[model samples]
Target: MQNALKELILQMADDALVLGHRNSEWTGIGPMLEEDLAFSSMAQDKIGHALALYTILHEHMGEPDPDKLGFMRKEEEYRCCQFVELPIGEYDFTLARHFLYDHAELIRYEMLVNCPFEPLAQMARKVRGELKYHVLHADTFLRELARGTEESKARMQAAIRYAWPYALGMFEITDADAQLAAAGAYAGEKERRSRWLSTVSSIINDAGLQVPEPDEAKAIYGGRKGYHSEYLKPLLDEMTEVVRLDPTAEW
Candidate 1:
């Protein structure tokens, strides 16, 4: 009913779409068999969530196809955080991304579950139910990796370092976040971000890992503004090419 809601919905839709594609990159390349399955399944869930969100956006926008919105959007038009577009690092890195994202989704969706908008709140509740399992799966793996062999520990630490800045990208404090909260589409971002950082920092400390200082003034930016890394375009081209091949073709 409002442009604010439209933009807010699209931001979530696009974030899930791109992040799902990024997660999908590890379909067969994970360090272990268990990890391969875990990452692949996580990617599936992210993509599934993206589909649901995009379907909502499509209906609201009077669009016909969800695939077009996910696949056909130009790079600069995408609203996915830069964190999702970065190349997949080792299994450790993969876990880092998963651990941060799943927990953040849990918090974000928990807030959204009570949104003023009934349809969006319903979707948030549905996705939050699924994210419960996703977060656990990631959390278990992160703990094991932290307590595993020396090599595993080193790699996990390195992954955490690599993933730290990107993790911050998850909190895109833009007009969209404000608008959504103002419209009752979501709880405010400020509170959510603080809770997320504290939650994540505790996990890091428990893992015997070090978390560097947090200076919001020094944080990296761009995903919210649509400037992504080199990884996004190629990923999207492969992801969307088949759909774009014949836009009228029915599944």
Candidate 2:
């Protein structure tokens, strides 16, 4: 159970850290100034979430500092899902990632809200507060894009198509999954993924957008086992370059 708890915390910490790095790409390039500020706020939230998760990891797992865990890890050693490491190619693509991740995250954290592990349960409560606004931001875009110009709609659909597989992969299970479930870490992953798809699909359909092709549309894999797309390395390099340079330096 202790190992299970550590792995579970690592899962959250890695995902939040990588996603924050990817989201930060929008710092100066978000579609509009308001969105720029808004997405950057989201990025900050992700980083902050990672920080909180890391604090727990250190205290409970006897792990190294969070910076060492986050910055020094090899790509293949990081436990983050593929969805976060994906390239934020265009506005729609970035938003699609946000939409998919925000929805997945809502369910994920909601599950954690009742985790048998106290630290995770407490962290989930904190993360859920921030993610409430995140869901609104992403869902607002989802609605607008679904009803906007044909081009916006089409692009959003394409982004949805591209990310749906990785999005499913976000809920991919691991060895700890069973123990987590047995210990009520967050319900079983299979059940949780089912709920996730239904919630996300319902929102898309309600927005008048086409239902995303099902997770079975493709392999719907990776990131659970440390495998990531080609886009991951460069992103991590940039994100950790400073930290990498001065491993012994204090912030």
In each prediction, how many residue pairs overlap at the backbone (N, C-alpha, C within less than 3 A)? 0, 0
- Computed on alpha carbons, the lDDT of every model, listed in order, comes to 0.78, 0.83
For residues 1-251, what per-residue lDDT tens digits would candidate 2 score against the true structure? 78877877788888888888878878888789898899889989999889888888888779987777888888888888888887778999899889888877878888888877788898898888889999999899999998899999899888888888788788778888888788767676687678878888888888887776664546456677888888888987887788777777876
Per-residue CA lDDT of model 1 for 1-251, tens digit only, reads 36667666776777777777777877777777776777788788888888988887777667646777887778888877777787776667778888887788789889888887777889988888888898888777788878989998888888877777777777767776677766667766577778888988888888887775666764556777788878888987888777787877975
Query: Which stretches of candidate 2 lie above 4 Å from their native place?
Result: none
- What's the true lDDT of residue 245 in model 2? 75
What's the CA error at residue 155 for candidate 1, in Å? 1.6
Measured by lDDT, the strongest candidate is 2
Q: What is the TM-score of each candidate against the true structure?
A: 0.92, 0.95
User: Which consecutive 10 residues in model 1 have the weakest lDDT in total?
Assistant: 212-221
lDDT of 2: 0.83
